[model samples]
Target: MNTTELFLVAMLIVFSIPYLIWRVFRTDYWAPLVVVQIVTGVLLGPGLLGAALPEVYGAIFTPPVIASLNGVAWWAVSLFVFLAGIELDLPLAWKSRRESAVTAGFALFTPLLAGCAAAALLLLVPGWVGPKAATWQFVLGIGMACAVTALPILILLMEKMDILRQPLGQRILRYASLDDIAIWGVLAIILLDWQRVGRQVIFLVLFALACWGLRWLMQRLAESDRWYVALVWLIVVALGADWCGLHYMVGAFLAGVALDMRWFDRDKLDQLRHHVLLVLMPVFFLSTGLRTNWTLGGATVFLAAALLLAASVGGKLLGIHLAARVQRWQPGEASLVGWLLQTKALIEIIFANVLLDKGVITSGTFTALLLMAVASTMLTVPLVTPMLKRNPGLIGRSG
Candidate 1:
């Protein structure tokens, strides 16, 4: 009836419904609870639940309730992305620079080319491109979405599949980590507001200085002290970035990457990540799904999703397979690595959301990319299960 009750109602639904479906149906093998939660967010959004029960949807998700939920969702994703940034093991990547470069480059670029082609076609349609987007921005935004790998989700899926600590899993993480940097860089390009370009330039200069000081302070602190400092740092950097037109998530990532992972205990860092996902990320998923639309109609959105998924999966596999040939990886390794690299749940959604906020892509395109991301993620475990099962020795091989 009131905002608090309604907010609680919304919270209860987001947390409960997805878990119930995931647990009751035993969807863990195919769709993890996080994926299920993302789907649930869509189902509860204007396109589905709202379309079916407009009054109820409006009543529950009133302005105040929506605002409150959004506050949680924003901080949830901010922290999650921050953690993703901190987890990047760039040192490991540097150790295997040659293999990492050729593979990561191809893995990012080929799909980028393919996705641009797909985006070019979508430009021929009207509803898919946002009003504020120039053609180049739209194309590049969609392409980056196609190329993104959800490092955090990839880790989760690999852990579930029991390969996360293995040599293969660690190697896969290196590839994803490099792409994570490129994804944000491209997003900055897409979001570059010429009017704000001066401000952005200033932000970069100051941010560099801040990072130096931040690094020095972090090195001197105890791990316990570092945790609180990191939070303060996350907020300040995120605000500064948003002020400069780079977006707060970019700031969040920069905030984390400025510090070393060795500063925190590895297991505690992992637990903090785990806690963020369990406690807060469901709100982000629901917030993301609420932004989805089928303005051109549901069938059109679904069809677009299918096309994008094909481009994403095909380009990723094609690129990895090519890289494998160049690097002389063993048989079946490309498929295993490519499939794992295609994980795109949280990061892809976050990328699409940023594009949508900046009006670089329309809701129709966002919905399509969101669907593509979920489908690509769901396909990973199912497709890789048989390969890992049959190969037996594929768990940890030197790359």
Candidate 2:
């Protein structure tokens, strides 16, 4: 069996799991569907099925095939970010910038700062040294991981809840967007220190300037008679950010902010999102699942996972509450935003994978973080919805 055939088989299984779950249960339990796909993928990978059906599974789980699938996943995420950019509304965020900034601040940067503080403190713990030890650098790495928010998933959740155009939804989305930009800047700094300090600093400044230039270009294109030209410029800027050592996501986000400044078209953005979600985004999620290794035999691994889960949940809520107080957000709204934003998804996982690839975090640590992210997200989804409904005047209010 070749990669294609194996992938086809994986795809078949991935597609069928939902139906199987639907048949077994009367509810739309996407989580179980996701779990089955991951479990099945692992079973069919070199771990299990390859050990049993050597020839058939080996061909599909080959290094080249895995790399190819990962590459596809990366591309899918890139598209996801691009569409995320398209969906943002600059005017709305601008109109509500102060409140949104407070929300976004608590939602992202507070946890990041807290994570950094924790990491800095954890560095002194005896014997926690070397490759996997809690060093200052590693602490910084963890902080970065904690600070990230996957806007696509947040937006999707908002849309599904039918609050996307509502006040709370707009406010949450706005803050999340603002937080995304700020976090990218932080990531650029981390990469600079991790990659090349001197060049990274210089490049970061240049990247900021380039973002300004790109914004101008996008705005011009948006206003021009040639609507298609805006998209072309967006692509150029998106790739250009990668060339300049900045994440392509930064470029995509800038493109979105620029688009928001001009014409905010929900229909067009939705169209792009629809295609990306059905086709590419699932590949990205499936690949994320494939990368996750849930098999754990050690108490240490379990402890680490548990600690991370507790920290992730506690940290976000605490951070958001503190930030809200600092920024003078209403108590009800603050609590709502804090609880909801704790949920992690693709962004944190993908970035952590990048960190692992860079040797900033070990594979074992990355796996732990991925689990922490998924667990936090799962817990939040069910919990946040009901909490928000309970506080209609705060988080549930429209306009």
Best-performing candidate as measured by lDDT? 1
lDDT value for candidate 1?
0.85
Q: What is residue 238's positional error in candidate 1, in angstroms?
A: 2.3
* Global lDDT scores for all candidate models: 0.85, 0.63
Error of 2 at 99 (Å): 2.9
Model 2 misplaced stretches (Cα beyond 4 Å): 2-4, 18-56, 113-134, 193-231, 261-265, 292-297, 395-399
Question: What tens-digit string does per-residue lDDT give for candidate 1 at 199-250?
Answer: 8788889999998899889889888999999999999989988888777877
The C-alpha stretches of model 1 lying farther than 4 A from their native spots are: 124-127, 296-298, 357-359
TM-score: model 2 vs. ground truth: 0.80
Give the per-residue lDDT digits (tens) of candidate 2, residues 1-399: 677777676566556654475467743333433334443454554535665677876655566666767777666666667666656666666776666666666667667766666555445543222364336557777776777767777766766766766777766766677777776666666566544555446655765676677666655654444347556656666676666556777776665555553353656667767787666655666666666433342555455656666666677778777776777766576667766676466677767766666666665566566666666666655776776677777755422
Model 2, position 267: C-alpha lDDT score: 68
